[model samples]
Target: MNKQTRPLLTLDQLWQFSLQYYSAREIKEACLHLQNHFHGNVNLLLTLKWLDEAQLTFAPQDWSTLTHSLTHIDALLRDYRDLRRKLKAQVSDALYKETLHFELQLEKQQQTALVNCINTLELNPCETPQLVEQYCLQLGAERLARIFIQPVQAHYHTP
Candidate 1:
Protein backbone atom coordinates (compact mmCIF):
# COMPACT_ATOMS: atom_id res chain seq x y z
CA MET A 1 0.00 0.00 0.00
CA ASN A 2 2.77 2.34 0.94
CA LYS A 3 5.66 3.38 -1.31
CA GLN A 4 8.03 1.04 0.50
CA THR A 5 5.71 -1.90 -0.15
CA ARG A 6 4.49 -1.20 -3.66
CA PRO A 7 6.45 -2.00 -6.78
CA LEU A 8 8.71 0.72 -8.11
CA LEU A 9 8.71 -0.47 -11.71
CA THR A 10 5.72 -1.64 -13.65
CA LEU A 11 5.67 -5.38 -14.32
CA ASP A 12 4.69 -4.86 -17.93
CA GLN A 13 7.54 -2.42 -18.50
CA LEU A 14 9.99 -4.75 -16.82
CA TRP A 15 8.83 -7.71 -18.87
CA GLN A 16 8.97 -5.70 -22.08
CA PHE A 17 12.46 -4.45 -21.30
CA SER A 18 13.69 -7.94 -20.49
CA LEU A 19 12.07 -9.46 -23.54
CA GLN A 20 13.47 -6.84 -25.87
CA TYR A 21 16.92 -7.05 -24.35
CA TYR A 22 17.05 -10.83 -24.39
CA SER A 23 15.84 -11.01 -27.98
CA ALA A 24 19.15 -9.69 -29.18
CA ARG A 25 21.21 -12.50 -30.67
CA GLU A 26 24.37 -11.72 -28.77
CA ILE A 27 22.64 -11.14 -25.47
CA LYS A 28 20.69 -14.36 -25.88
CA GLU A 29 23.87 -16.24 -26.65
CA ALA A 30 25.61 -14.92 -23.58
CA CYS A 31 22.64 -15.52 -21.29
CA LEU A 32 22.24 -19.07 -22.54
CA HIS A 33 25.89 -19.62 -21.86
CA LEU A 34 25.46 -18.54 -18.29
CA GLN A 35 22.21 -20.42 -17.95
CA ASN A 36 23.45 -23.68 -19.41
CA HIS A 37 26.96 -23.56 -18.06
CA PHE A 38 26.68 -21.65 -14.81
CA HIS A 39 23.03 -22.42 -14.02
CA GLY A 40 22.24 -18.73 -14.06
CA ASN A 41 18.65 -17.57 -14.13
CA VAL A 42 18.29 -15.60 -17.33
CA ASN A 43 15.23 -13.82 -16.06
CA LEU A 44 16.98 -12.65 -12.91
CA LEU A 45 19.93 -11.43 -14.86
CA LEU A 46 17.60 -9.53 -17.13
CA THR A 47 15.78 -8.12 -14.13
CA LEU A 48 19.06 -6.87 -12.71
CA LYS A 49 19.90 -5.31 -16.03
CA TRP A 50 16.53 -3.64 -16.16
CA LEU A 51 17.13 -2.11 -12.76
CA ASP A 52 20.45 -0.83 -13.90
CA GLU A 53 18.91 0.70 -16.99
CA ALA A 54 16.28 2.33 -14.86
CA GLN A 55 18.94 3.67 -12.51
CA LEU A 56 17.19 2.12 -9.55
CA THR A 57 18.49 1.08 -6.16
CA PHE A 58 17.47 -1.62 -3.72
CA ALA A 59 18.29 -2.31 -0.10
CA PRO A 60 19.68 -5.49 1.42
CA GLN A 61 16.34 -6.17 3.06
CA ASP A 62 14.78 -5.99 -0.37
CA TRP A 63 17.13 -8.67 -1.61
CA SER A 64 16.23 -10.87 1.37
CA THR A 65 12.54 -10.45 0.66
CA LEU A 66 13.06 -11.21 -3.02
CA THR A 67 14.97 -14.36 -2.18
CA HIS A 68 12.28 -15.55 0.17
CA SER A 69 9.53 -14.91 -2.37
CA LEU A 70 11.35 -16.47 -5.27
CA THR A 71 12.97 -19.51 -3.61
CA HIS A 72 10.08 -21.96 -3.89
CA ILE A 73 9.00 -20.70 -7.29
CA ASP A 74 12.54 -20.93 -8.54
CA ALA A 75 12.76 -24.51 -7.27
CA LEU A 76 9.58 -25.35 -9.15
CA LEU A 77 11.08 -23.90 -12.29
CA ARG A 78 14.18 -26.02 -11.80
CA ASP A 79 12.07 -29.13 -11.36
CA TYR A 80 10.13 -28.37 -14.51
CA ARG A 81 13.34 -27.62 -16.36
CA ASP A 82 14.83 -30.98 -15.36
CA LEU A 83 11.63 -32.77 -16.27
CA ARG A 84 11.55 -31.03 -19.62
CA ARG A 85 15.10 -32.04 -20.39
CA LYS A 86 14.34 -35.62 -19.44
CA LEU A 87 11.25 -35.56 -21.58
CA LYS A 88 13.27 -34.27 -24.49
CA ALA A 89 15.71 -37.11 -24.04
CA GLN A 90 13.10 -39.84 -23.69
CA VAL A 91 10.31 -38.75 -26.02
CA SER A 92 9.89 -38.76 -29.76
CA ASP A 93 10.16 -35.67 -31.96
CA ALA A 94 6.55 -34.49 -32.03
CA LEU A 95 5.95 -35.10 -28.36
CA TYR A 96 9.19 -33.43 -27.40
CA LYS A 97 8.32 -30.39 -29.45
CA GLU A 98 4.91 -30.13 -27.81
CA THR A 99 6.38 -30.48 -24.35
CA LEU A 100 8.98 -27.93 -25.24
CA HIS A 101 6.28 -25.40 -25.96
CA PHE A 102 4.74 -26.07 -22.56
CA GLU A 103 8.08 -25.72 -20.90
CA LEU A 104 8.66 -22.41 -22.63
CA GLN A 105 5.34 -21.13 -21.40
CA LEU A 106 6.17 -22.30 -17.92
CA GLU A 107 9.37 -20.31 -18.08
CA LYS A 108 7.43 -17.20 -19.09
CA GLN A 109 5.10 -17.70 -16.14
CA GLN A 110 8.07 -17.77 -13.83
CA GLN A 111 9.41 -14.59 -15.34
CA THR A 112 6.07 -12.87 -14.98
CA ALA A 113 5.83 -13.84 -11.34
CA LEU A 114 9.34 -12.61 -10.77
CA VAL A 115 8.72 -9.23 -12.34
CA ASN A 116 5.45 -8.91 -10.44
CA CYS A 117 7.15 -9.61 -7.15
CA ILE A 118 9.85 -7.11 -7.95
CA ASN A 119 7.23 -4.53 -8.81
CA THR A 120 5.84 -4.89 -5.28
CA LEU A 121 9.11 -3.79 -3.75
CA GLU A 122 9.81 -0.10 -3.29
CA LEU A 123 13.02 1.28 -4.81
CA ASN A 124 14.64 4.59 -5.54
CA PRO A 125 16.38 5.67 -8.72
CA CYS A 126 19.95 6.91 -8.56
CA GLU A 127 20.41 10.64 -8.23
CA THR A 128 23.36 10.27 -10.55
CA PRO A 129 23.75 7.90 -13.50
CA GLN A 130 27.24 7.03 -12.37
CA LEU A 131 25.81 5.21 -9.38
CA VAL A 132 23.51 3.03 -11.46
CA GLU A 133 25.99 0.23 -11.96
CA GLN A 134 26.90 0.22 -8.30
CA TYR A 135 23.25 -0.24 -7.36
CA CYS A 136 22.70 -3.09 -9.78
CA LEU A 137 25.85 -4.99 -8.81
CA GLN A 138 24.51 -5.30 -5.29
CA LEU A 139 21.70 -7.54 -6.53
CA GLY A 140 24.06 -10.29 -7.58
CA ALA A 141 27.63 -11.17 -8.29
CA GLU A 142 29.76 -10.08 -11.23
CA ARG A 143 28.34 -12.55 -13.72
CA LEU A 144 26.89 -9.96 -16.06
CA ALA A 145 29.68 -10.55 -18.52
CA ARG A 146 28.48 -14.11 -18.85
CA ILE A 147 24.85 -13.12 -19.38
CA PHE A 148 25.04 -9.86 -21.25
CA ILE A 149 26.54 -9.21 -24.67
CA GLN A 150 27.98 -5.98 -23.34
CA PRO A 151 28.08 -5.93 -19.60
CA VAL A 152 26.85 -2.61 -18.25
CA GLN A 153 29.94 -0.47 -17.78
CA ALA A 154 29.16 2.41 -15.47
CA HIS A 155 32.29 3.11 -13.49
CA TYR A 156 32.47 5.62 -10.66
CA HIS A 157 35.13 6.19 -8.04
CA THR A 158 34.13 6.74 -4.45
CA PRO A 159 36.29 8.96 -2.32
Candidate 2:
Protein backbone atom coordinates (compact mmCIF):
# COMPACT_ATOMS: atom_id res chain seq x y z
CA MET A 1 0.00 0.00 0.00
CA ASN A 2 1.05 3.57 -0.66
CA LYS A 3 1.59 6.29 1.96
CA GLN A 4 -1.88 7.74 1.69
CA THR A 5 -3.49 4.35 1.87
CA ARG A 6 -1.44 3.14 4.80
CA PRO A 7 -3.25 3.09 8.11
CA LEU A 8 -1.95 5.24 10.93
CA LEU A 9 -0.34 3.32 13.77
CA THR A 10 -1.98 3.54 17.16
CA LEU A 11 -0.56 3.45 20.68
CA ASP A 12 -2.04 0.04 21.43
CA GLN A 13 -0.65 -1.42 18.23
CA LEU A 14 2.78 0.01 18.96
CA TRP A 15 2.65 -1.19 22.54
CA GLN A 16 1.64 -4.68 21.47
CA PHE A 17 4.37 -4.73 18.85
CA SER A 18 6.91 -3.64 21.45
CA LEU A 19 5.75 -6.22 23.97
CA GLN A 20 5.99 -8.98 21.40
CA TYR A 21 9.46 -8.10 20.22
CA TYR A 22 10.85 -7.09 23.60
CA SER A 23 9.87 -10.49 24.92
CA ALA A 24 12.21 -12.08 22.43
CA ARG A 25 15.62 -12.70 23.98
CA GLU A 26 17.62 -11.53 21.01
CA ILE A 27 15.61 -8.37 20.52
CA LYS A 28 15.80 -7.67 24.23
CA GLU A 29 19.55 -8.12 24.21
CA ALA A 30 19.97 -5.94 21.16
CA CYS A 31 17.80 -3.22 22.63
CA LEU A 32 19.62 -3.30 25.95
CA HIS A 33 23.00 -3.30 24.22
CA LEU A 34 21.99 -0.23 22.27
CA GLN A 35 20.70 1.40 25.42
CA ASN A 36 23.67 0.53 27.65
CA HIS A 37 26.50 1.06 25.23
CA PHE A 38 25.24 3.62 22.73
CA HIS A 39 22.68 5.60 24.70
CA GLY A 40 20.04 4.62 22.17
CA ASN A 41 16.36 5.02 22.96
CA VAL A 42 14.65 1.64 23.17
CA ASN A 43 11.24 3.20 22.65
CA LEU A 44 12.38 4.81 19.44
CA LEU A 45 14.11 1.66 18.29
CA LEU A 46 10.96 -0.30 18.90
CA THR A 47 8.95 2.37 17.14
CA LEU A 48 11.29 1.95 14.22
CA LYS A 49 10.54 -1.74 14.24
CA TRP A 50 6.84 -1.04 14.31
CA LEU A 51 7.12 1.45 11.50
CA ASP A 52 9.16 -0.93 9.43
CA GLU A 53 6.52 -3.56 9.94
CA ALA A 54 3.95 -1.09 8.71
CA GLN A 55 6.11 -0.11 5.75
CA LEU A 56 6.27 3.47 6.95
CA THR A 57 9.25 5.79 7.07
CA PHE A 58 9.74 9.00 8.94
CA ALA A 59 11.09 12.15 7.40
CA PRO A 60 14.10 13.89 8.87
CA GLN A 61 12.01 16.57 10.52
CA ASP A 62 9.74 13.92 11.99
CA TRP A 63 12.72 12.25 13.62
CA SER A 64 13.87 15.56 15.07
CA THR A 65 10.43 16.34 16.40
CA LEU A 66 9.90 12.90 17.89
CA THR A 67 13.30 12.81 19.56
CA HIS A 68 13.04 16.38 20.83
CA SER A 69 9.57 15.78 22.23
CA LEU A 70 10.74 12.66 24.04
CA THR A 71 13.96 14.04 25.53
CA HIS A 72 12.66 14.72 29.03
CA ILE A 73 10.83 11.42 29.41
CA ASP A 74 13.77 9.53 27.94
CA ALA A 75 16.08 11.17 30.48
CA LEU A 76 13.76 10.10 33.27
CA LEU A 77 13.64 6.55 31.91
CA ARG A 78 17.42 6.42 31.71
CA ASP A 79 17.82 7.51 35.30
CA TYR A 80 15.17 5.11 36.54
CA ARG A 81 16.65 2.28 34.53
CA ASP A 82 20.04 2.89 36.07
CA LEU A 83 18.52 2.86 39.53
CA ARG A 84 16.58 -0.30 38.74
CA ARG A 85 19.73 -2.07 37.62
CA LYS A 86 21.58 -0.95 40.73
CA LEU A 87 18.79 -2.21 42.96
CA LYS A 88 18.49 -5.59 41.27
CA ALA A 89 21.15 -7.24 43.39
CA GLN A 90 20.53 -5.26 46.56
CA VAL A 91 16.76 -5.44 46.76
CA SER A 92 14.56 -8.45 47.44
CA ASP A 93 13.27 -10.27 44.40
CA ALA A 94 9.75 -8.96 44.99
CA LEU A 95 11.05 -5.39 45.28
CA TYR A 96 13.10 -5.77 42.14
CA LYS A 97 10.06 -7.09 40.31
CA GLU A 98 8.06 -4.09 41.45
CA THR A 99 10.77 -1.79 40.14
CA LEU A 100 10.71 -3.66 36.86
CA HIS A 101 6.95 -3.19 36.68
CA PHE A 102 7.32 0.52 37.33
CA GLU A 103 9.94 0.77 34.62
CA LEU A 104 7.58 -0.95 32.19
CA GLN A 105 4.91 1.60 33.06
CA LEU A 106 7.34 4.40 32.31
CA GLU A 107 8.17 2.76 29.01
CA LYS A 108 4.46 2.64 28.14
CA GLN A 109 4.19 6.33 28.96
CA GLN A 110 7.04 7.04 26.58
CA GLN A 111 5.28 5.02 23.90
CA THR A 112 2.09 7.00 24.50
CA ALA A 113 3.95 10.25 23.99
CA LEU A 114 5.58 8.80 20.89
CA VAL A 115 2.22 7.89 19.33
CA ASN A 116 0.91 11.35 20.01
CA CYS A 117 3.93 12.89 18.34
CA ILE A 118 3.65 10.46 15.45
CA ASN A 119 0.04 11.41 14.79
CA THR A 120 1.09 14.96 14.02
CA LEU A 121 3.89 14.06 11.65
CA GLU A 122 4.16 13.36 7.94
CA LEU A 123 5.53 9.93 7.08
CA ASN A 124 6.81 8.49 3.86
CA PRO A 125 6.23 5.09 2.32
CA CYS A 126 9.34 3.07 1.60
CA GLU A 127 11.59 0.39 2.91
CA THR A 128 12.78 1.57 6.35
CA PRO A 129 16.22 -0.01 6.70
CA GLN A 130 17.88 3.18 5.50
CA LEU A 131 16.06 5.14 8.18
CA VAL A 132 17.04 2.61 10.80
CA GLU A 133 20.61 2.68 9.59
CA GLN A 134 20.64 6.46 9.73
CA TYR A 135 19.43 6.37 13.31
CA CYS A 136 21.93 3.68 14.32
CA LEU A 137 24.79 5.48 12.64
CA GLN A 138 23.85 8.67 14.47
CA LEU A 139 24.15 6.69 17.68
CA GLY A 140 27.50 5.28 16.46
CA ALA A 141 26.18 1.77 16.95
CA GLU A 142 26.61 0.09 13.62
CA ARG A 143 27.13 -3.34 15.17
CA LEU A 144 23.90 -3.10 17.10
CA ALA A 145 22.18 -1.91 13.93
CA ARG A 146 22.96 -5.20 12.27
CA ILE A 147 21.41 -7.01 15.18
CA PHE A 148 18.28 -4.94 14.84
CA ILE A 149 17.95 -5.54 11.11
CA GLN A 150 18.89 -9.18 10.92
CA PRO A 151 16.17 -11.82 11.14
CA VAL A 152 16.28 -13.79 14.32
CA GLN A 153 16.18 -17.59 14.33
CA ALA A 154 12.74 -19.18 13.91
CA HIS A 155 12.50 -20.31 17.51
CA TYR A 156 13.37 -16.80 18.65
CA HIS A 157 10.67 -15.33 16.41
CA THR A 158 7.91 -16.34 18.75
CA PRO A 159 6.93 -13.51 21.03
Candidate 3:
Protein backbone atom coordinates (compact mmCIF):
# COMPACT_ATOMS: atom_id res chain seq x y z
CA MET A 1 0.00 0.00 0.00
CA ASN A 2 1.16 3.53 -0.72
CA LYS A 3 2.13 5.64 2.32
CA GLN A 4 -0.80 8.00 2.03
CA THR A 5 -3.26 5.24 1.25
CA ARG A 6 -2.03 2.82 3.94
CA PRO A 7 -4.32 2.00 6.83
CA LEU A 8 -3.91 4.10 9.97
CA LEU A 9 -1.17 2.74 12.17
CA THR A 10 -1.96 1.45 15.64
CA LEU A 11 -0.41 3.29 18.57
CA ASP A 12 2.05 0.46 19.11
CA GLN A 13 3.23 0.66 15.50
CA LEU A 14 3.32 4.44 15.69
CA TRP A 15 5.45 4.18 18.82
CA GLN A 16 7.96 2.03 16.96
CA PHE A 17 8.14 4.53 14.12
CA SER A 18 8.44 7.43 16.55
CA LEU A 19 11.32 5.73 18.32
CA GLN A 20 13.16 5.31 15.03
CA TYR A 21 12.47 8.84 13.76
CA TYR A 22 12.17 10.85 17.02
CA SER A 23 8.70 12.01 16.07
CA ALA A 24 7.49 13.72 19.22
CA ARG A 25 3.80 13.68 18.44
CA GLU A 26 3.74 9.99 17.60
CA ILE A 27 5.65 9.18 20.75
CA LYS A 28 3.33 11.33 22.76
CA GLU A 29 0.29 9.60 21.33
CA ALA A 30 1.75 6.20 22.10
CA CYS A 31 2.50 7.27 25.64
CA LEU A 32 -1.07 8.42 26.12
CA HIS A 33 -2.18 4.98 25.03
CA LEU A 34 0.24 3.36 27.45
CA GLN A 35 -0.94 5.63 30.22
CA ASN A 36 -4.50 4.59 29.61
CA HIS A 37 -3.45 0.96 29.60
CA PHE A 38 -1.38 1.21 32.79
CA HIS A 39 -3.37 3.79 34.70
CA GLY A 40 -1.39 6.61 36.31
CA ASN A 41 1.68 4.58 37.11
CA VAL A 42 3.31 5.46 33.78
CA ASN A 43 3.36 9.19 34.40
CA LEU A 44 7.04 9.37 33.54
CA LEU A 45 6.54 7.83 30.14
CA LEU A 46 3.56 10.05 29.61
CA THR A 47 5.50 13.13 30.66
CA LEU A 48 8.22 12.25 28.19
CA LYS A 49 5.67 11.91 25.47
CA TRP A 50 4.18 15.25 26.41
CA LEU A 51 7.56 16.91 26.29
CA ASP A 52 8.45 15.43 22.95
CA GLU A 53 5.15 16.24 21.30
CA ALA A 54 5.58 19.28 19.02
CA GLN A 55 1.93 20.05 19.51
CA LEU A 56 2.16 20.12 23.26
CA THR A 57 2.38 23.44 25.04
CA PHE A 58 4.75 24.05 27.94
CA ALA A 59 3.87 27.05 30.09
CA PRO A 60 6.14 28.61 32.73
CA GLN A 61 3.47 28.49 35.41
CA ASP A 62 3.07 24.78 34.82
CA TRP A 63 6.77 24.40 35.54
CA SER A 64 6.35 26.14 38.88
CA THR A 65 3.48 23.85 39.81
CA LEU A 66 5.32 20.71 38.82
CA THR A 67 8.43 21.75 40.71
CA HIS A 68 6.43 22.71 43.77
CA SER A 69 4.65 19.37 43.74
CA LEU A 70 7.88 17.41 43.59
CA THR A 71 9.47 19.46 46.36
CA HIS A 72 6.43 18.99 48.55
CA ILE A 73 6.44 15.21 48.07
CA ASP A 74 10.17 14.89 48.79
CA ALA A 75 9.86 17.04 51.88
CA LEU A 76 6.95 14.96 53.11
CA LEU A 77 8.95 11.75 52.69
CA ARG A 78 11.98 13.25 54.44
CA ASP A 79 9.82 14.45 57.29
CA TYR A 80 8.32 11.02 57.62
CA ARG A 81 11.77 9.47 57.72
CA ASP A 82 12.89 11.91 60.39
CA LEU A 83 9.84 11.18 62.47
CA ARG A 84 10.54 7.48 62.21
CA ARG A 85 14.14 7.93 63.26
CA LYS A 86 13.17 10.08 66.21
CA LEU A 87 10.58 7.58 67.34
CA LYS A 88 13.08 4.76 66.96
CA ALA A 89 15.73 6.46 69.10
CA GLN A 90 13.19 7.38 71.76
CA VAL A 91 11.96 3.83 72.10
CA SER A 92 13.40 2.03 75.13
CA ASP A 93 13.01 -1.56 73.88
CA ALA A 94 15.43 -3.00 71.34
CA LEU A 95 12.73 -5.15 69.77
CA TYR A 96 10.42 -2.14 69.30
CA LYS A 97 13.22 -0.11 67.74
CA GLU A 98 13.96 -2.87 65.29
CA THR A 99 10.30 -3.22 64.47
CA LEU A 100 10.01 0.51 63.83
CA HIS A 101 13.04 0.42 61.58
CA PHE A 102 11.57 -2.43 59.56
CA GLU A 103 8.24 -0.64 59.29
CA LEU A 104 9.88 2.57 58.13
CA GLN A 105 11.77 0.72 55.42
CA LEU A 106 8.58 -0.90 54.25
CA GLU A 107 6.76 2.41 54.21
CA LYS A 108 9.53 3.93 52.16
CA GLN A 109 9.37 1.14 49.62
CA GLN A 110 5.66 1.78 49.22
CA GLN A 111 6.27 5.44 48.36
CA THR A 112 5.56 5.80 44.62
CA ALA A 113 4.87 9.51 44.33
CA LEU A 114 8.47 10.63 44.65
CA VAL A 115 9.77 7.88 42.44
CA ASN A 116 7.20 8.58 39.74
CA CYS A 117 7.90 12.30 39.83
CA ILE A 118 11.62 11.80 39.44
CA ASN A 119 11.18 9.32 36.63
CA THR A 120 8.85 11.63 34.76
CA LEU A 121 11.13 14.64 35.10
CA GLU A 122 14.17 12.75 33.93
CA LEU A 123 12.46 11.43 30.83
CA ASN A 124 12.26 14.91 29.27
CA PRO A 125 14.21 17.73 30.88
CA CYS A 126 13.58 20.26 28.10
CA GLU A 127 9.97 20.64 29.14
CA THR A 128 9.18 23.13 31.89
CA PRO A 129 7.51 20.55 34.14
CA GLN A 130 10.29 18.04 33.79
CA LEU A 131 13.07 20.58 34.40
CA VAL A 132 11.44 22.20 37.40
CA GLU A 133 10.43 18.94 39.03
CA GLN A 134 13.96 17.56 38.77
CA TYR A 135 15.49 20.72 40.18
CA CYS A 136 13.11 20.74 43.12
CA LEU A 137 13.73 17.10 43.95
CA GLN A 138 17.49 17.60 43.87
CA LEU A 139 17.51 20.80 45.91
CA GLY A 140 14.96 19.59 48.42
CA ALA A 141 16.92 16.44 49.16
CA GLU A 142 20.14 18.35 49.73
CA ARG A 143 18.55 21.01 51.91
CA LEU A 144 16.63 18.53 54.02
CA ALA A 145 19.62 16.29 54.63
CA ARG A 146 21.75 19.27 55.66
CA ILE A 147 19.13 20.85 57.88
CA PHE A 148 18.47 17.65 59.82
CA ILE A 149 20.94 15.23 61.54
CA GLN A 150 21.56 17.25 64.68
CA PRO A 151 21.92 14.09 66.75
CA VAL A 152 24.60 12.71 64.44
CA GLN A 153 26.61 15.91 64.79
CA ALA A 154 26.33 15.89 68.60
CA HIS A 155 27.09 12.20 69.14
CA TYR A 156 29.30 10.96 66.28
CA HIS A 157 33.02 11.72 66.30
CA THR A 158 35.09 11.05 63.23
CA PRO A 159 38.46 9.47 63.92
Candidate 4:
Protein backbone atom coordinates (compact mmCIF):
# COMPACT_ATOMS: atom_id res chain seq x y z
CA MET A 1 0.00 0.00 0.00
CA ASN A 2 1.18 3.52 -0.81
CA LYS A 3 0.54 5.34 2.42
CA GLN A 4 0.48 9.12 2.71
CA THR A 5 3.51 10.34 4.63
CA ARG A 6 2.24 13.82 5.32
CA PRO A 7 -0.07 14.14 8.32
CA LEU A 8 -3.65 15.30 7.82
CA LEU A 9 -3.52 18.85 9.20
CA THR A 10 -7.22 19.68 9.35
CA LEU A 11 -10.60 18.21 10.18
CA ASP A 12 -11.77 18.49 6.56
CA GLN A 13 -8.88 16.34 5.30
CA LEU A 14 -9.52 13.73 7.98
CA TRP A 15 -13.24 13.71 7.26
CA GLN A 16 -12.62 13.36 3.52
CA PHE A 17 -10.20 10.49 4.06
CA SER A 18 -12.73 8.83 6.37
CA LEU A 19 -15.55 9.19 3.83
CA GLN A 20 -13.38 7.67 1.12
CA TYR A 21 -12.19 4.87 3.37
CA TYR A 22 -15.65 4.07 4.67
CA SER A 23 -17.15 4.07 1.18
CA ALA A 24 -15.72 0.62 0.47
CA ARG A 25 -18.31 -2.03 1.27
CA GLU A 26 -15.74 -4.41 2.66
CA ILE A 27 -14.21 -1.70 4.77
CA LYS A 28 -17.61 -0.69 6.06
CA GLU A 29 -18.47 -4.28 6.92
CA ALA A 30 -15.18 -4.78 8.69
CA CYS A 31 -15.68 -1.64 10.72
CA LEU A 32 -19.21 -2.56 11.65
CA HIS A 33 -18.09 -6.05 12.57
CA LEU A 34 -15.48 -4.65 14.88
CA GLN A 35 -17.95 -2.22 16.33
CA ASN A 36 -20.65 -4.82 16.96
CA HIS A 37 -18.49 -7.72 18.07
CA PHE A 38 -15.60 -6.10 19.86
CA HIS A 39 -17.23 -2.96 21.29
CA GLY A 40 -15.06 -0.73 19.18
CA ASN A 41 -15.73 2.90 18.48
CA VAL A 42 -15.95 3.27 14.70
CA ASN A 43 -14.75 6.85 14.61
CA LEU A 44 -11.76 6.03 16.79
CA LEU A 45 -10.91 3.11 14.53
CA LEU A 46 -11.17 5.34 11.50
CA THR A 47 -9.01 7.96 13.15
CA LEU A 48 -6.39 5.28 13.83
CA LYS A 49 -6.44 4.33 10.16
CA TRP A 50 -6.05 7.94 9.15
CA LEU A 51 -3.15 8.38 11.50
CA ASP A 52 -1.63 5.15 10.26
CA GLU A 53 -1.80 6.38 6.68
CA ALA A 54 0.06 9.50 7.72
CA GLN A 55 2.63 7.42 9.67
CA LEU A 56 1.81 9.30 12.84
CA THR A 57 1.92 7.85 16.35
CA PHE A 58 -0.21 8.99 19.25
CA ALA A 59 1.53 8.90 22.59
CA PRO A 60 -0.13 6.84 25.29
CA GLN A 61 -1.06 9.86 27.38
CA ASP A 62 -2.46 11.66 24.39
CA TRP A 63 -4.51 8.62 23.44
CA SER A 64 -5.96 8.47 26.96
CA THR A 65 -6.80 12.16 26.98
CA LEU A 66 -8.41 11.89 23.58
CA THR A 67 -10.59 8.99 24.61
CA HIS A 68 -11.52 10.68 27.88
CA SER A 69 -12.61 13.81 26.04
CA LEU A 70 -14.82 11.81 23.75
CA THR A 71 -16.64 9.93 26.50
CA HIS A 72 -19.81 12.03 26.37
CA ILE A 73 -19.96 12.02 22.58
CA ASP A 74 -19.34 8.29 22.46
CA ALA A 75 -22.21 7.69 24.84
CA LEU A 76 -24.50 9.80 22.69
CA LEU A 77 -23.37 7.97 19.55
CA ARG A 78 -24.05 4.62 21.15
CA ASP A 79 -27.49 5.72 22.25
CA TYR A 80 -28.37 6.95 18.77
CA ARG A 81 -26.96 3.85 17.15
CA ASP A 82 -29.00 1.66 19.43
CA LEU A 83 -32.12 3.68 18.70
CA ARG A 84 -31.46 3.52 14.96
CA ARG A 85 -30.98 -0.23 15.03
CA LYS A 86 -34.06 -0.72 17.14
CA LEU A 87 -36.20 1.36 14.81
CA LYS A 88 -34.96 -0.24 11.62
CA ALA A 89 -37.67 -2.84 11.38
CA GLN A 90 -40.34 -1.23 13.51
CA VAL A 91 -40.55 2.13 11.82
CA SER A 92 -41.47 3.38 8.37
CA ASP A 93 -38.68 3.56 5.80
CA ALA A 94 -38.58 7.34 5.91
CA LEU A 95 -38.35 7.33 9.69
CA TYR A 96 -35.54 4.79 9.63
CA LYS A 97 -33.69 6.87 7.07
CA GLU A 98 -34.06 9.94 9.23
CA THR A 99 -32.62 8.09 12.22
CA LEU A 100 -29.71 6.91 10.10
CA HIS A 101 -29.06 10.44 8.88
CA PHE A 102 -29.03 11.72 12.44
CA GLU A 103 -26.66 8.94 13.45
CA LEU A 104 -24.31 9.94 10.64
CA GLN A 105 -24.33 13.52 11.88
CA LEU A 106 -23.25 12.22 15.30
CA GLU A 107 -20.49 10.27 13.64
CA LYS A 108 -19.23 13.44 12.00
CA GLN A 109 -19.32 15.17 15.35
CA GLN A 110 -17.22 12.40 16.87
CA GLN A 111 -14.72 12.71 14.04
CA THR A 112 -14.54 16.43 14.53
CA ALA A 113 -13.74 15.94 18.22
CA LEU A 114 -11.10 13.36 17.32
CA VAL A 115 -9.42 15.74 14.91
CA ASN A 116 -9.53 18.55 17.41
CA CYS A 117 -7.89 16.40 20.11
CA ILE A 118 -5.11 15.20 17.84
CA ASN A 119 -4.40 18.66 16.50
CA THR A 120 -3.29 19.86 19.95
CA LEU A 121 -0.81 17.06 20.48
CA GLU A 122 2.69 16.53 19.17
CA LEU A 123 2.82 13.26 17.26
CA ASN A 124 5.76 11.28 16.02
CA PRO A 125 6.46 9.27 12.87
CA CYS A 126 6.05 5.51 13.15
CA GLU A 127 5.46 2.38 11.11
CA THR A 128 1.81 2.27 10.06
CA PRO A 129 1.08 -1.25 11.23
CA GLN A 130 2.50 -0.61 14.69
CA LEU A 131 0.18 2.26 15.41
CA VAL A 132 -2.86 0.31 14.26
CA GLU A 133 -1.80 -2.81 16.09
CA GLN A 134 -1.38 -0.89 19.33
CA TYR A 135 -4.91 0.46 19.04
CA CYS A 136 -6.32 -2.95 18.20
CA LEU A 137 -4.57 -4.43 21.18
CA GLN A 138 -5.94 -1.69 23.36
CA LEU A 139 -9.43 -2.50 22.14
CA GLY A 140 -8.76 -6.26 22.44
CA ALA A 141 -9.68 -6.59 18.79
CA GLU A 142 -6.38 -7.78 17.44
CA ARG A 143 -8.03 -10.35 15.15
CA LEU A 144 -9.72 -7.65 13.08
CA ALA A 145 -6.73 -5.31 12.96
CA ARG A 146 -5.65 -6.58 9.56
CA ILE A 147 -8.90 -5.41 8.03
CA PHE A 148 -8.06 -1.82 8.92
CA ILE A 149 -4.38 -2.02 8.01
CA GLN A 150 -4.62 -3.79 4.65
CA PRO A 151 -5.50 -2.02 1.45
CA VAL A 152 -9.13 -2.05 0.40
CA GLN A 153 -10.31 -4.40 -2.37
CA ALA A 154 -9.24 -3.57 -5.92
CA HIS A 155 -12.75 -2.73 -7.07
CA TYR A 156 -13.19 0.06 -4.56
CA HIS A 157 -12.33 3.60 -5.68
CA THR A 158 -12.09 6.95 -3.94
CA PRO A 159 -15.06 9.16 -4.70
Instruction: State how far residue 108 of model 4 sits from its true place (Å).
Output: 0.8
Clashes in each model (backbone N, CA, C under 3 Å)?
A: 1, 0, 0, 0
Give me the runs in candidate 3 sitting further than 4 Å from their true place.
1-66, 69-79, 92-111, 118-159
Report how far residue 107 has shifted in candidate 3, in Å.
6.2
Task: Evaluate residue 150 in candidate 2 and report its C-alpha lDDT on the 0 to 100 scale.
Answer: 59
Off by over 4 Å in 2: 1-7, 151-159
Rate residue 139 of model 2 by lDDT.
Answer: 98
Residue range 1-159, candidate 3, lDDT tens digits: 455543322333333433443334443443344324432212333233334432233445555544444454445444654576677656768866776666545434323343333333323234323432333244443332221212213323457
Task: Write down the TM-score of every candidate.
Answer: 0.70, 0.86, 0.26, 0.86
Report the C-alpha displacement of residue 80, candidate 4, in angstroms.
1.2
Model 2: how far is 82 from its true place, Å?
A: 1.5
> On TM-score, who's better, 2 or 4?
2
> lDDT of candidate 1 vs native?
0.64
TM-score of 1: 0.70
Candidate closest to the true structure, highest TM-score: 2
| Candidate 1, superposed: residue stretches over 4 Å from native | 2-8, 127-159
Candidate 2, lDDT over the whole model: 0.80
Residue-level lDDT of model 2, residues 5-99, one tens digit each, is: 54477888999888877888878988888888998899988887777666778777677898887887988998999999988889999999999
